[model samples]
Target: MRVAVVQVGYGDAEPVPERVERVAALVRAQAGHDLVVLPELWAPGGFAYREWQDRAEPVDGPVGQAMSAAARDAGVVLHAGSIIERPGGGEVGPDGHGLWNTSLVYGPDGGLLAAYRKVHRFGFGAGEPKLLDAGEDVVVVDLPLRDGGSVRAGLSTCYDLRFPELYRRQVDAGATLFVVPAAWPAARVRHWTLLAHARAVEDQCVVVACNTAGTHAGTEMGGHSQVVSAAGEALAMAGADEQVLSVDVDLDAVAAWREQFPVLRDRRL
Candidate 1:
């Protein structure tokens, strides 16, 4: 599968609408890629605590609309990244936070394929934990490939990368591809890279980690968007900038590696 990982950045100076336009143009440019991924909360600003509520919108809102059109125009499946979703229904979380940090996926036809609400809120007492409700469902979707078949993809947001069991669950659910959209900061870049490799090797699956770049609200984002093969080899990686790292992954290799090692089958659980 051909994947295009778009590492984007935006600070307090750029307007949200303008940022959306810039990202949409990038997505539209990946016409031949089977899948296109983006970083989390690029529009609402990942670390911009003050802007979350004001920038929150539904899945079909302007940002989603722009991404849908972009996916359709480019003729590729697009992982539009996580958005600050201000959904209705009056539902509340454990901390009384009603909003959700949601990840959205669009098909080649510009249709909404899946929406994964982040189950693991990042902040301990502030930020996401205080402002957003925790997601309950584990989301997995079949991303349609341009060549006719589909790839089973498991979805998880930024903080979820630290949890290996979550990815083990994806592996059990028949997911050969794990898509992690993160807004990880520069301070923890080592953890981001190490954990990504660990997950790929442990789960024996393709790991596509798309991280944010540039400074947002005085916070520096770690921008090493990468694709790791089933053997934990880095297929492609990007630098700390607004760039796209495209790589080709062989899904069949995942099965081959698992069969050769056969470690997963020995699980007592």
Candidate 2:
């Protein structure tokens, strides 16, 4: 399968709608890709954590609408990164509060295939635990290709990379491709690259990590978007700049590796 990873540049200066439109145009320009992945919180900047309430939209809002259109126009399955969404009032938990950091997956038919909220919230600097609600479920969806094959894709965002158990669960659920959309910072560029490869090797799956470039609210991002194979090989990588990194992934190879090694069969839990 041909996958396009978009390394987006984030800045608080641009309007959210304009940014979404620009990225959608970029995705549309890259024709013939089976899947298009965007960075986390590509619509409203990730650093705008405090302003989430103001910028948050419903799942059927403009951002999701634009993504549906873009996916259909591009003829690719889109992992539309993530956005701050406000769940309907009374749809939330006991507290009655309603908002989530959600990722929406759209098929080539422009239909919603999966919706995943960020399971692990980043709580180091600004402390996300105090701001956003944590998600409870893991999302993995099968994306059908035109050639009569399908890729089992797993959904994750940003800080979720630090947790390997999630990826293991995805692999156990028959995921061959892991997609991580992040806004990782420049201060931890090394960790960003290392962890992605580690997950790919450990899970024996393809890892396509798309991180944002540029700065957002004084925090500069490490824009080394990369695609790693089941053997921990870097198929394609981008520097600290905005660019699209496309790589061909062989789903057959994943099965061959797992069948030869059979490491997953030894799991105790």
Candidate 3:
């Protein structure tokens, strides 16, 4: 399938509404691609901890509505990065609210395909852990292919990259492609690249990793959006900036590599 990885760049100067508008336009621009992916929390600013609550919105909020329309307009499956989700319910946290770092997906017809609440929060005791509820289930969805049929894809957010078992579970569930939307910082970009390839090699699936660019809350984002094949090859990569990368993902290669290597079957633990 043809994929577009949008490495968005922004700073504290950019307002949330304007950022949402810009991102929606970017998604709409990828009409020819089968799937379009964005980086995490571009609207609310991933590292801008203080602004999360004020900018937080429900699943059908402004950004979500705009993206759904863009997906329909473009006729492509869209992974609209992530949002600071203010989950609707009576369940309240210590701060008298509940939230989640939620990833949203829209199908070609502009319908909600999947919503993955980030399983792992970045901050240990503070930040996300203090405010947001952790997601329990692993998420995978079927996306259309270039020729016909669909490909099973696994979804995970930024910090979850450190955990191999998450990808392993998705592989066990028959996922052949993995989509990771991150707001990774510049300091650990090497780890970001390393872990992406590691997950692709270990799970024998195509890994699509899209990261943020520019700066947010004084922290510089690592902008190296990349697509790694099942054979651990970098099909395409983007530099540290706000740009979109288009690459064709070969689903058949997953089966071929797995059959030739058969590494997953040898799992002992």
Candidate 4:
């Protein structure tokens, strides 16, 4: 599968609407890729906590609309990074934070394929924990391939990358590819690269991680968006700037590697 990972940057200077328009164009530019991914909270600044509540919108809001159209135009299954979502009709979840950091996936036909709310909230009682409700679902969707076959892809965002159990559950659900969109900071970027490869090695699945770049809200985003093969080899990686890392991945390689190693068969617990 040919994948395009868009490493976007969010700054205080650019207006949100303009950023949306620019990013939509970027998505449209990846016409031949089978799958395209964007970084988390590119529309709403990742560290701009003060602006999240004001900018929150529903799944069908402007961001989703533009992404759906862009996905159709590009003719690729697009992971439109994440958005700050406010549930419509005044509904509320368990935490009652009134908002969620949600990742959206769109099909080639611009149809809504899946929406994964981030299960792990960051900020340790601040930021996400204080402002947003936690997601309860483990999301996995089948990505349609050019050859008429499909690959099961598990969805998680940002801080969820640190939790191995969540990915293990996805592996149990028959996911061969893990799609992660993060807004990880530059301070802990070393952990980001290490954990991405670790997830691929431990789960024996291909890991596609897309992260942001540039500074927003005084925080520098880590932009080493990468693709790791089932064998934990880094197939492609982007620099700490706004760029795109396009790589061709073999979906069948996951099955082949797992069968050859047969490590998962020995799991007792």
- What is the alpha-carbon lDDT of model 2 when measured against the actual structure? 0.87
Task: Indicate the worst ten consecutive residues by lDDT in candidate 1.
Answer: 87-96
lDDT of 2 at 56: 85
- Taking the tens digit of each residue's C-alpha lDDT, what string does model 1 give over 1-269? 99999999778899999999999999999999999999999999899889888998888999999999999999999999989987667666676777889999999999999999998988887788888889988888999998899999999998999888888888878899999999999999989998999999988889999999999888999898899998999999889888899899999898899899988888897
Instruction: Arrange candidates by lDDT, descending.
Output: 4, 1, 3, 2
lDDT of 3 by residue, 11-45 (tens): 98887888888888888889989999999898898
The segments of candidate 2 whose C-alpha lies over 4 angstroms from its true place after superposition are 94-97
164-266 per-residue lDDT for model 2 (tens digits): 9999899879899999999899999999999999999889999999999989878899999999989889999999989999888887989899898877788
Question: What tens-digit string does per-residue lDDT give for candidate 4 at 103-217?
Answer: 9999999999999999999999999999999999999899997778889999999899999999999999999999999999999999999999999999999999999999989
The TM-score, computed over Cα atoms with residue i paired to residue i, of candidate 4 is 0.99
Please give each candidate's TM-score.
0.98, 0.95, 0.96, 0.99
TM-score of 2: 0.95
Model 1 residue runs over 4 Å out of place are none
Best by TM-score: 4
Q: List the residue pairs that clash in candidate 3.
A: none
**What are the clashing pairs of model 1?**
none
How much lDDT does candidate 1 score? 0.91
The model with the greater lDDT, 3 or 4, is: 4
**Candidate 2's error at 58, in angstroms?**
1.1
Q: Which regions of candidate 4 are displaced past 4 Å?
A: none
